[model samples]
Structures are given as C-alpha cells and as structure tokens.
Target chain A: MAADKVDPIHQFHITKILPINVGHYDVSFTNSSLFMAMTVIAATAFLILATSGRSMVPNRWQLVAEMSYSFVANTLRDAAGKAGMKFFPMVFSLFMFVLVANLLGMIPYFFTITSHIIVTFCLAMLVISTVVIYGIWKHGFHFFGLFVPSGVPAALVPLVTMIEVISFLSRPISLSVRLFANMLAGHITLKVFAGFVVTLSAAGVAGMAGAVLPLAMAVALTALEFLVAFLQAYVFTVLTCMYLNDAIHPGH
Target chain B: MASNVNTTAEVHHGGAEHGGAFPPFDSSTFASQILWLAITFGLFYVLMSKVVLPRIGGILEARHDKIAKDLEEANRLKADSEAAGAAYEKSLAEARKKAQAIASETRSVLNAALDAKRHEAESSLSTKIAAAETAIAGIKAKALAEVDGIAIETAETLVSTLAGESVGRDEVAAAVAAVTAK
Candidate 1:
C-alpha cells in the first residue's frame, strides 16, 4: 500500500490559477472558471457552426441544431405556453452549460462543474429569483394568492397555506440538490469502480481477471451517466419553465 | 488480498486527508466560481438571445413563409389550369353540336332542292305527252279526208274507163259515202 494515492474526491477541488485581490476579495481565475468559459465557447461554436449556413433544407448538423432548438422551444411551450419563450435564452444557456459540464466530467481528467454545490445552487438561485421578481412585478399583491388552495375547506386554509409556503421556499434547495447530488454521486461511483479496476489489475493475474467485472460495471455506469446527463438537463429546463409559468400566472 | 485491503484503506484516508471532507464544502473557491458562472451565463444569454436564437428563428420563419407561398402559388396554378381545361372542353362540345346542326340543315336543304327539280321535270313531261296526242289525232283526221278524195277520184276514173265516159267527183263521193256507211 502506498502512503500517497490518488483520491477520487480530489477531482472536485478548485485551485486558483491566477490570484487577484481587490479589497480582501478573492476573484482569481481557476479550473472551474476555465471549464465554464469552455462550456460557453463550445456552446457558442456549436450553435454558430451549425447555423452558419442557415439552409432551408437543413443538413445533418443543421438538423441537430434545429432539433435542440425546437426541443427546448417545445418544452417551454408545453410547460408554460408561448409566454415562456421570453426566457428561452436563459433556459437554453442553463441547460447547455449543465449538460456540457456533465458530459465533460465523464472525460478522464476533466472537472465536473455542476458537481459543485455552489454552481448548482447559484443556478437554482437564478431560477427562483427570476420567479419571485417576475411574479411580483407581474402579479403585484395578487401573487400571494398562489399560497392559497381554492378547493380547501375554510378551516384548513391556514394549514394548506403553510404547506404551500414551505414547498415554495424549498424549490431552490431541491432543484440545486437534485442536480448536484446526481452529478456528485455518479462521478464518485464511477471513480470508485475505476479505482477498483486499477487496484485489482495491479494484483496477480487472477486479480486482473476479477478486475474485468468492475471495469464492466464502470462502463455500464458511464453509459447510465450519459443518459443522466441529458435527463438532468431536460429536468432542469422543464422545472425552470414550470416555475416561470407560476410567475406568469401566479394563481394555484 | 491483504495488500489490496491496505491500499483500499489508504485510498479512503488519502481522499479524506488531501481532498478535504468534501471538495465542494471548501469555501475558498465559491466566490470565483460564482463570479465566473455569472459572467459566463450572462455572455451565453446575450449570445443566445441576441445572435443565435433570432437567426434560427428567422430562418425557420423564412422557410415557413416560402413553403406557404409556394403552396399558394401551386394552388392558384392548378385552379387556373382546371378552369382552362373546363373551358376547352365546353368549347369542344359546342363545336361538335354546331357541326351536327349544320350538317342536318344542309341535308334538308339539298333534299328540298332535289324534290323541286323532280316536280318541274314531271310537269313538263306530262304537257309534252298531251301535245303529242293532239297532233296525232289531227294527222289521222287529215289522212282520212285525203283518202276519201283519192278513193273518189280512183272510182270516177275506173267508171269512166269501164263506161268509156268521165263521171262527176260529187257523185263519186256520194257513192263512196254510201258504200262505206253500208
């Protein structure tokens, strides 16, 4: 057994690359920042390259681009109707960033940006804030009616309202934790299985034979993680649309 | 197996010691991560809203309009050709009817002309026949009178020759008449 070994959790560490200080505030560039930029660049390049031709009779790449565009567009339309399309940019960017981050994390050496609670929480905060601010702006005092259930018995109104408020407040927490936990757990499991492969293969030939099982499991988990990557992005975008629907129409 | 267990334990210990209790719980990097997230998200939003989405939307809208316009034009052309075809068919039917009417009228007119000509020829032939019959009757009466004179003369000559003297024409005629009556 070696005293120093590679740690699976260490992949989640954020190290400062360039240090900047302004009045005791640390705003240095880091690996997370780099990946975020890369996500943006990758998304931008993909969209630009795919649509550069803008052919009416779309080629394969254009079809893919159009499919993704219409996918989010249809989801928003279905979840929140046409009014939800106003936030298409925000929702699309969030989905792409998270999706690309999750996929990139599957690479052997790349960091998983969405695995960090800060990133997921920030995204969730943005969604909740938009809902709150827009709801108040659009509905004014009537927005509070969202807490009241119309079919409730008069005696149970307070209890229903309390439950509604609690659920409402928990939206950001659940949204952030859902994505963060899934990514974090998936990445950890993959690393552990991969570690098992490395450890077993380092043993005798018999151990190497056993290592095939963990390697196969890691491979299967990877495939599952790819599906999860896409699913989580879709879930996040769908929930964002639903929340926006609440803002647009602030009643139960 | 013992070595494998030892390495597994060391891996766990190393993960906890070196990578902290949880790498995400490390607070030193939150500010930069959030800041960069905000910046990158804002950039992406701007690019999507201002540049990419509108372009795609415009292309889609353009294609929709083109398809609709092409369909409308095709419908118009089809309708126009159908109308022309109907008009052509109607005119063809009318032409056939007119030709048939002309042919029947011409046949009737030609038949009437032939009937008129035949009637005129028949009337002329009947008049000619009546004239020819009247002439034949006159010729027969004249021939009878001449024969009477010749017979009287011949009888007078014969009587004169037999009696050795000339007889009178009035008497001979009276004698012939009496013998013919008997």
Candidate 2:
C-alpha cells in the first residue's frame, strides 16, 4: 500500500469545496450539501412535471404522481387514522426526500447524506421530538401518564413506567442507527469486493479465475443494496407514523 | 442483536481509541446534517402540498364518480328486468284464461249433444210400447171368436150321440137355445 493512500471513509467526508470560516465552526458549503440541494430541486421538478398537465383520466406521469401521493396518504391513514391527516405533509415529504437522496446516491461519485449517522440521527431526532412535543401539546400534562400501563397492579406501576420511559427514549436511537448501519455496512462491503476484483485482475490467469467469484458477488450485493435503500426509507417513514399514532392517542 | 450492535460500535470506537489510528467521529458534520434536513424538508413540503395532494384528490373524486355511474347502470338494468318479468306474467294469465274459455265452450257443446240424443231415445221407446199393446188386443179378440165356434159344435155332437138317432142340427140347436133361455 502507498503511504499517501486515502482511506475510503475520508473520501466520503464533506470538506468545503470553497473553504470558509463561520465563527468557530466550519460551516462552508460542501459536496454533501450540494447533493442535498440537488435532490430538493430534482424532487420539485419531478412533482411539477408529473402533475402540471392533470387529466381527468390521468396520463402515465399523472398516474405515477397520484400513486405516490395515495401510497403515502393510505399508509398514514392506516397507521394513524384521521388524526394523521395533519401530519401527512411532514411524513410524505420525509419519504420523498429520503427516497430521492438514497436513489441519487447510487449515481457514481455522489455523496449519500443518509449513510452518515449524524444526518440520520438529526432526522430521527426531529421525528421523535415532533411526536413527544405534539403529544404533550395535544394531551397537556396528562401525557406523562402514557408511561404507566393502565391495567397493571399498583405495586408494579413504578417498574412499568421506568421500562416504558426507557423504551420511549430508545426510539430515536434505534430509528437512526437502523438506517445508518445498513447504508454504511452495505457500501463498505461493496467497496471491499470491488477491491478484491481489482487486486485479482492484476495477478495473471489464475487470479482472474478467482476474481470471477468476487465480481459476481459484488454485482449481486449492489442490486440488493439498492433494494435495501428503498426498504429502509419506507421502514423509517412507517415507524414514524406508528410513533405519531401513540402521540395522538396516548391512553393506548 | 443489542450485543452485536455494541460490538460493532466498540470496534468503531476502539479503532479511534488506539492512537488516532482511524478518523474520530467528526462533530463538524452536524452543521451539514442540519442544513440537509432543512433543505429536504422544505422541498418535500412544497412538492406534496402543491403537486401531490391535489392530484390524489382528483383521483379519489374520479373513482367516486365511476362507482356512482356503475350503480346507476345496475339499477336501470334491474328495473328493466322487473318490468319484463311483470309482462310475462300478464301474458301467461291471459293465455290461461283463453284456454279455460275454449274448454268451457267445448263442454257446452257436449252437453247439448247429450240432451238431444236423450230426447230421441225417449220418443222411440214410447212408440214401441204403443205397438205392443195393439198386438195384444188383436190376439184376445181372435181367441174369443174361436171359443164361441168351438162351444156350438160340441153341443150338437153331444146331443146326436145320446139319442141314438140322427137328430137335425137345427133341432139340437133350438133345444140348447131353450135350455139356455130358461
């Protein structure tokens, strides 16, 4: 290995393309920020194009937009009922952003913001805080009683409350880590197998034969990763709805 | 699962602990993360509220219209079937009445034929009885005439034998006449 060889993770880092200092923190725009902006622009353009020429019977593009809307609408309705209508905009937007970002990252050399724990954690925190604050606002001080199981014996109320509170706090941790770990591990494994293919191809005929297996595996993993990316986004959005449901109806 | 995740996390932290061997978890990424969240959030909000929701509302309204149209068509078909069924029943009733009228007409004709036949038979029987009575009266008259002739001849024969002489028929007859008169 060369002394100056860069680590793969460092390649993923978002150092400012045009360095700028803001107070003590380095808040200059980076490659990750650029892609995030691009994702927003692309989503806006796609939705506008899809729905601009709305037809009574719907064309192909219109059908796609309608399906995407109804898909999220129905998911929220099923998970949280009529109470979820207020949260529809938030949930639908989250799904589109995550879905678009994950898909865009598949393009070679594009940064995947969702693959970073800090990014995933911030989103998770937003969702968790929304549910907690909304639940309190909607239910007032009585929302604290959500931690206590109604049918339990009085003797065990304290223990059950503690367990419930701990579980409640674990929500953001689990939600954030689930997305982050899947993206990080999948990308790293893909890189490793790609490294294997390169290393073997240089070592003559015998090495080429060995390269065939890892190359096949790499191809398979890439397709699987793409599916995982979409699935993880769906899981994150759906779990957010479930949490929102508890917030709306705290007695349950 | 928890243990496995902890071990992975331990490895990640362990790599950093052993003298900057690996990159430490960067705190600087926080700003970028927040920026990305905000941008994505705004993008999604505008797109959904303006473009997505309205399209969905249109589809729902269209589906509702289609369902209502189908129900109207079904209701019309049902009414038509019921009307057709009623018409068939009326025709069936009319046919049954016509059949009963034809049967009654045939019955009346049969009754008239039977009455006429009965009258002719009674007349023939009465005529035959009258002819038989006339024949019986003629037979009695003939028998009475034969009996008168036979009584006169027998009286004459008897008188002639008893007297041992040829007594004239007129004398015998006269004696018989006198005795009959006394």
Candidate 3:
C-alpha cells in the first residue's frame, strides 16, 4: 500500500462487465448496471416479501414497508394533492432506487449509481417529462398558464413568464445536479479522508496520531453521508411531487 | 498525493492525461448508464405499481379497517355489559321492595293474630271476675241477714225471761225490724 494514492474518483468509474454493442452504441452491461439491477431486485424483494404476511399487526419489515409507503404517499399528496397520486409509481420508484443505491454505495468500494449525473438526469427528466405530458394532456393549452403566475402586474407578465419558463426548463438540470453533486461530494470526501488516514498512519507514530483527526472526521462524515443519502432521496421525491403538482393543477 | 493521483490516473488511463473527464461527467458512459437506469427503474416501477404497492396498501387498509372493527366491537360489548348491569340493578331493587312488602305483610298478619288472642283472653278474664264478685255479694248479704235475725232473737228472749212472760210474735217481728233498720 506504500506510495499508492487513494483515488477518490476511482469508485465512480464505470467498467464494462458484459459488453453489449448495440448497433455502434456501447450499452455494455457495466458495474453501474449491475448495481441498478441489484437495487431493483433488493427493493422489490424487500417490499414484496416483507409484506407477504400482510398481518393485521405488522412486523418490523412490514412496518418499514408501510411507513415508507405512507411517507411517499403523504409527500405526494401534500405536494401535488390527490390528483398527483397517478404518478405515485414513478415517484416511488425513483425514491426507492435512489435511496437503495445511495445506501448501497455506502459500502466500501461500491460504485454509487446516483453519483453519476446522467442517471440523476434521467430520473429528473422522467419527472419533468411526466409533468409536461400530463399537464398538456389534462389541461390542454391551459397548462401553459403555469408559467404565468396569478396577480402579477400586466407590465411584468412577460418578464415573469420568461423567468418562469427558464426556471421550469432548469428543473431537470438542477434536480440532477443537486442529487449528483451531494452524493459525489460526500463519497469523494469520505474517500479522501480515509485515504489521508491511510497515508498518514503509514508515516510514523506522530503521523498515526495525526491520522486520528481524519479518522474521526471520516466517521462523522460517514454518519452525515448516510443522512445525506436519505435526505437526497427525500428531496428528490419531494421535488418530483412538486413538479407533478404543476401537471395536476397547472394554473396554480 | 497529487503526484500519486496523477501517476495512477496516467497509468490507469493509458496516458490519457491527468485532467481527463471525471468519471461522473464522462459522456461515454451516459448511454450505458441511461439504458440501464431505464431498464431497472422501469422494472421497479412496474413491480411496485403492479404488485408490491397495492399489496402493501391492501395490508395497511386491512389493518386499519380491522382496528376500527375491533374498536366498534369493544364498544358494543361495553354497552351490552352496561345494559346487563342496569338490568341486574333494576331487578335487585325490585326484589328488595318485594322482600320488604312480604316482611311487612308477615308482621301485620302476626300482629293481627296476637291481638285476637289477647282480646279473647281479656274477655274471658272479665267474665270470671264478675262471677267471683257476685258470689262474694251473696255470701255478704246472707251473713248480714243472719246477724239481724240473731240480734232480734237474743233481745226478745231476754225481755221474755226477765218479765216472766212470753212476748207476742208480731211484736218480736216489729222489734227485730226496727233494730235491724237502725
């Protein structure tokens, strides 16, 4: 381990597992894909099997499943109202996927799926696209009213609407960037701190004592990272709900 | 640390340089990542909406309804027990009243019988007292009449023997009557 620098960025690197060339596009099954698959299976299995008992009095696993269910349900209801519940599956899927992936990434050496901007972009796009499609479909041309807020002065209408449009367009970018950045920064910081401990402790007795600081920081950061993991998921879901709200009642 | 990171990045990238695109921002991996995300997230969505979510919702709803039903049943039972308790109290009160009535009736009946017996005994005692008084009166009158007669006979006999002459019967009678009267 001497002179070997801990590469914080290495963990996020996507390596081809089973390469699949799809007509000049390399959509190879990578470690990222494996983890996604794992996330899907894990989330599905846990949610399904835990509630298999369907007991009137829920056990621990069932209780967690129910709590998460109601948590998302409440979030969706609060943000978008009952009409937004039609997109519950999509919102819930993204939340579970992000949450599970983030937690899985907490394991040492695990590739974080959410750390990638493209993945979060796709999820953000999914939410935005749903808002667009459903908004247009449900309310027709009236959905465009979302950009025009009520009670604005007639002179500022154009300016306010343009700002609204730009803001609306930036939703996907910000949504993706926020989650990606949080996870990316957290994981990298943890790795760098851990690397410091390793590099320092190998130096000397004094270096080992100095390593304790980073070590403690690493432990504290790990706890914070876990919180960030759940928080990001919640934020993502909440934002998704809010975006879906635009679709349900665009005038508001 | 900087040299080491650069050195490894160089070696790892086949000398693709130190400032090459970070893996997260890498465009080459986007296609693969997007494809897989769609596949996995789509699968998860389908599984949740189709199977898992509804199942969990059903469980929660069932538990909710079951709890409500149990509560309602408990309330009903409570009311039922209260009704039975009220009925018990009512009967207890009725029985107490009936028992008091029966006791009073029995006491009154016994009292009537005792009064009748007392009255019969008093009347019989009064008749016996009257008979004793009448017998005493008869004795007393006979004694009194004998005393008067004895006094008159003795007086007449004294007068006759002293005067050496027998007294007339009518005069003796008249003399006895006057002495008795006085």
**lDDT scores of the candidates, listed in order:** 0.86, 0.77, 0.89
Q: Per-candidate TM vs. native?
A: 0.79, 0.70, 0.88
After superposition, the stretches of candidate 3 with alpha carbons farther than 4 Å from their true spots are A1-5, B1-6, B14-19, B131-135, B146-182
- What's the C-alpha lDDT at position B70 in model 2? 83
Residue B34 alpha-carbon offset, candidate 2, angstroms: 0.6
- lDDT value for model 1: 0.86
A1-252 in candidate 2: lDDT tens per residue? 210111245435554665556677666677777777887888777877877776666788777777777888888899999988899888888887888888887665677778777777878888889999999999987788889888899999999999999999999989989988888777777777776886677679999999999999989999998998889889989999999998898873
The DockQ-derived docking category for candidate 2 is: incorrect
lDDT by residue (A1-252, candidate 3, tens digit) is 332337787777788899998987879999999999999998999998899888888899999999999999999999988888888888888889899999999998788999999999999999899899989989999999888888899999999999999999999999999999999999999999999998899789999999999999999999999999999999999999999998888773
Error of 2 at A178 (Å): 0.6
DockQ of each: 0.32, 0.17, 0.53
lDDT of 3: 0.89
Where is model 1 more than 4 Å wrong at Cα? A1-10, A20-26, A192-221, B1-19, B118-182
Docking class of 3: medium
Best by TM-score, which number?
A: 3
* Least well predicted 10-residue stretch by lDDT in candidate 2 chain A: A1-10
Candidate that scores best on lDDT: 3
TM-score of 2: 0.70
Candidate 2 lDDT for residue A103: 82
List the candidate 2 regions with Cα displacement exceeding 4 Å.
Answer: A1-11, A18-21, A52-61, A150-160, B1-24, B75-79, B82-86, B89-182
